[model samples]
Target: MKKHVAWHIVRACLLPAVLFSSRALADCAQDFARDNAYKPHAGAHRMHERKLPLSLLDGQWVPTLKQEIINTISEVVPPNATRITSDGLFGPIGLVVIGDRGWIRANGDAAWEPLNAAESKEILDGAFTSYLSFNRMSDLSCTRAEHNGRPARVYHYKMPSELQIGSHSEITAYFDDQTGLPVHVEVEDGNPRQRAKSTVSIAFDSAIAIQPPETAGQTPRAGNADPSGRRKSLYKHPPGEAL
Candidate 1:
């Protein structure tokens, strides 16, 4: 089994700025760092540390929002070593694996299946690597701002890799002006000529669980069947490559 880690970046841009109140903006920024920032398991190297204002955690909405984000992430990227990058609007734009050797990239219509897992990982790693590199080199900025009556923290980062040439990606976490919990996320990216935008709305007090699709009553393949009628892999890789 693959050990999956859930990672998602949400953004929004090019929209009217008059939507949010100043107070909301502050709250959202704090929540963004809190909900999204998490340390790797013990003994694991720490990548980044983001701190949240204590005031934001006092509201009941914080834990609610956190659970929603976690559930949403679990749906597309299983708990195995998975990395998901999206405009944070419509759906996932790309998914890479540390679980399997493959990946899936989206281009508006259907997703494109690459030739192999190595190719998929290469594209995902390249895109992110390029994004980080450009963010460091350019006038990239991230700030807490209000938009459309919601509090949000915006990220304006540059994309340097050839794969993302002429592209810009933005992420915004939307917090309710009255409550600190994030209600939605907006993400935008692509070239200046043509852009892809996505908005993801989160429902409070909702239960989102990640579970395997039901396959009840289905018989397992001859070679795949175990004594319990569950499907099993016919071949297993050596220990090191198992995941």
Candidate 2:
């Protein structure tokens, strides 16, 4: 009878271990099957699918406003630039090129020379992505307001950081009701002491290219002079001169 009791206790312990192992294996198999089945659906679900209805524009249209803002910003082709004056307006004031290397006219001559690439990169990166990330829209609330003499959607978004004194910042985006093209974006950082304001404007134009100048690979003109006149150093732009 004692031997029988010992055998029963050992059997009970073994049965639980066996059952637990089988259940764990079954759960892993089920997880694998679910992962395989959802692989195709995952891609489809990630895309933006819903279209906004026209009649919903009367009061605070949150989703439509958010989508429009995202679409406009995302459409900006990376590193797109053109010749602009020192004042930051596009024109033929001086030769300017933007790409892997940014170049500007040094002496107002037709000759295009390289700008300080590191400085330009810092400014551009800060102006675009860094600023966007610093003040991202946490909760988008839309309100109807007059934008450029037409009724448009004005969105209020919560500022991501505690440095901003106000609980939220306002983003006023003017969009064409029919075509959904964004005309302007306005953001206000609500501190009277804040000196810098963030604003980005988009313009559509057909002619923007970053073609290398004809003098890109040519030997330096100083090297072609008499050997005595040519400087021995290979450095193109020396210190104290603007790059």
Candidate 3:
């Protein structure tokens, strides 16, 4: 896994005047060293919940677009590997991010498929790469605070149009004050009305390898999952690949 033992330059997103000082940077790094160090291991895990924009689901088949999401349902692990899963509209979907390669355990016990196609970039991006990008701290400004129970700090940032979640404009993250591990995240979709909102939390991390259920169901393969099987090879990223 990627470990930052020394101080690396922080690519500040703002002007020098608002730049973080050396001491501040050190503190930030120290507070988040464990988090920053964990480039992701073969056993690390991540669970998140992201709500898609209602507009995207405005088609004839999915007309109503009720609040459905590929919700994450696991804890974030450290050091070795990470496995992520979500509740898809049809059933449940999962990704096993091991050895820097994304192996997807599509519905059923069909076979472990590798994400290597260009079109599968969205899945690859949202599955694991984005999870790594989410940890890039130099671009964010953080303040110390206590959230829930852990000694925590909050980092704030503005998302570009492409990175925005649905109609959200801002992103806020809560990290473990001591370990620097992210505990909770909130994406503000609306302000005045507080209509559509998105939130994700890192419930916990375990000191073990991530694995799929022993009795994984035996659902038949979909008649058509990217007819070209493009999703099987969408990306070639190890845990250490650049964001």
Candidate 4:
């Protein structure tokens, strides 16, 4: 399989921080907006996600990357610092971001490589925009429901063509009514050849410190000067899609 290495890292670590799909409903819009405004001083998040590809004949979902499973633990400190550890389809990966600078390491490597401008832009620019940006999609519907026995709001919407990964893509999201926080999200994308689906669940921690990992060296990876060159990533975000 052809892996979009950089895309994977971007998705595996940061995508869970951005979730949900919505538009139209005034209450949903307001609630989702509040979620976007949330930026806690310190906390930790745990996410688990599974992805599968669909077969044409029977519409059965099959494992494309050997039943890819992504588990991430992200911790944040004051002043926007974050450290994410992810066990992705490829292996283990880590990312750290402090202000405008970030570093990435893969496969339990000791050294952390700093992200270049273009690469950093690609990963961070939209990493947290999905929920806020999806409000632009034209057709969105919402309903009130219960999740985990708590009041919740549900939203289902199709991604805009420009943001789609395949012939079409759709998302369903659940938000906590009391807290205005996203609890779960599901996404499905497909084309004539195959279909893909990803589901993620989130949990938060009240206290955690996000610090850079100690490493022996900081040498750059060969061939990475070219942004398009093959490398590595984990969560596997598709190109051209909104985070």
Candidate 5:
């Protein structure tokens, strides 16, 4: 379990070290996001899937590489990043967070529930993998650069060969210049057919407080997120079909 105080540490640049997929992985990226109708211009596919320089991180693969990246994230990504968000092939995946706990609105239900510490750690992985759990991979990347108008540090690691040839997951984060609260967190799902990006830049502190429900019934109490516990698309149509 990530330390409960991990929430306090969240306000730092560590907002979104990573990004999601849903359903089975017969074809991970392709099938995982098929239920989502969003697709980028087929022309933009190449650019969207473009691999930024791997030199983003400082060193080559070492035995302690994963741990080293973890340490750097604990030091860098958080102190500067303000908000954490994810984007699927569709759009902003409905993940809301207040302090350390976050909620995923599943099954078209309006109600929201708290995410367990382990669950949150998986998403923010000190790297990115939206809905998927964080597993160590070889040849990860890290760097600090200005993306868009916002200045942020970026981190990403290689996806498995099976996911796709150019396939990888990455995120750029920004911090609220004034309060130092997280202002923006974004993830890039590298598929051109069904491009996905999730962002979280709104509702923080007193702006939008997400408290636990008074009654236990209102809270789904989903621990570690069992396969059966995940939320399916609200209305349900086949993958690639329009909502």
Candidate 6:
């Protein structure tokens, strides 16, 4: 899948932020200052993301759109694999990638069709870099909070307008208090044409591994998926090829 598409998928699974008291805000700001100084190691992580549709009502955004038709599910396995399922005209459609090779299939379809060379290249080029992008953030606000009964730090910030999906966005991120690693993220953006909300849940050191799907529910054609059909292939395109 392309980077933009993968990014959209990654945006799917997050929770909206809630306000906290002034005392909690002070502690959160202190935590942000300290945590932002050190980079924590988040090795071989996975994510489940979902995007929700929104509508405008009385000058506010609400999740009142056709929920059934406006949902997307995404799974990520860094540094080179992602799978996304979204509502399609017919039904749910699925796209998956492991390294340079990938597959696609509609809901209820038995066979997983292989992606073309062009798409495979996009998948390889669009591999995820990091779960969080904390560099050069602006208009930062934070609060101490609890997520699932555990101590949490929630940050509300504005990214550079040029870097946001729309002209502006409201971004909220939840981090583990002790680890300083991200746990969930929510991004809501609006423009004259459309409005969107997305959430993502991050899991560090996930044991679930992404593998290439079998074509037609049958075994992979031997030697086509890397030298061995079972192992992952971290294939890189030759330089100067079409991206």
Selected candidate, larger lDDT, 3 vs 4: 4
CA shift of 83, model 5, Å:
13
Q: Candidate 1 lDDT (Cα, whole model)?
A: 0.32
- Between prediction 4 and prediction 6, which has the larger lDDT? 4
Residue range 93-211, candidate 2, lDDT tens digits = 22333544655432222245565666345333432231122133444444566656866544444443222444555544444444333445555543322221335454443343435
For model 1, how does the per-residue alpha-carbon lDDT over 1-243 read when each residue is reduced to its tens digit? 011211213111101122222333465333433443322221111111121111122232121121123212312222233334432212234444443354443411223343265544543343322111123222334566776756665544333322155554565444444544444555555432223344555443223232221332233233421122311231121112211
Candidate 4 at 15: error in angstroms? 8.0
Which prediction has the highest lDDT against the true structure?
4
Off by over 4 Å in 6: 1-45, 57-65, 78-80, 88-90, 104-128, 133-143, 159-166, 192-194, 216-243
| Tens-digit lDDT track of model 5 for 1-243 | 122323333323233222332322334333322311212211110001111111111333122111111210111122111123222212222343334555554322223446776765543443221222233232333444554565543434343332246676555434333333333445554343333333533222223223433432373344433323222432122223321
Per-residue lDDT of candidate 3, residues 1-243 (tens digit):
000100011111101122233444465444433353333443344546675433222222221123334355544344334455555433355555443444555443244455445423433333333242332223456687888866887866544333333332566778776655677877654322122356776554455466544434444465644323432232221111221
* Residue 214 local lDDT, model 5: 42
In terms of lDDT, the poorest run of 10 residues in model 6 is 234-243
Candidate 6 has which clashing residue pairs, if any?
Answer: 12-50, 12-51, 12-199, 13-49, 13-50, 13-199, 13-200, 14-199, 14-200
User: Each prediction's Cα RMSD?
Assistant: 17.8, 25.4, 11.9, 6.7, 17.6, 12.6
| Per-residue lDDT of candidate 4, residues 1-243 (tens digit) | 112453465553454333444343477656555664534532445445555644454454444433354455555454445666766543466777765777777644335767666655545444433322362343466788998999988877666432234344687778888877777888777766456777867666656565655662466445334322232232233322211
Task: Please report the candidate that would top TM-score against the real structure.
Answer: 4
Better of 1 and 4 by TM-score: 4
Give candidate 2 regions above 4 Å deviation. 1-135, 149-151, 160-169, 190-192, 195-202, 207-243
Model 1: residue 172 alpha-carbon error in angstroms? 3.3
Off by over 4 Å in 5: 1-105, 109-166, 175-183, 202-208, 214-243
Candidate 6 Cα deviation (angstroms), residue 197 = 3.1
The local distance difference test score of model 6 is 0.54
lDDT for 43 (candidate 3): 38
User: Local error of candidate 5 at 140, Å?
Assistant: 5.4
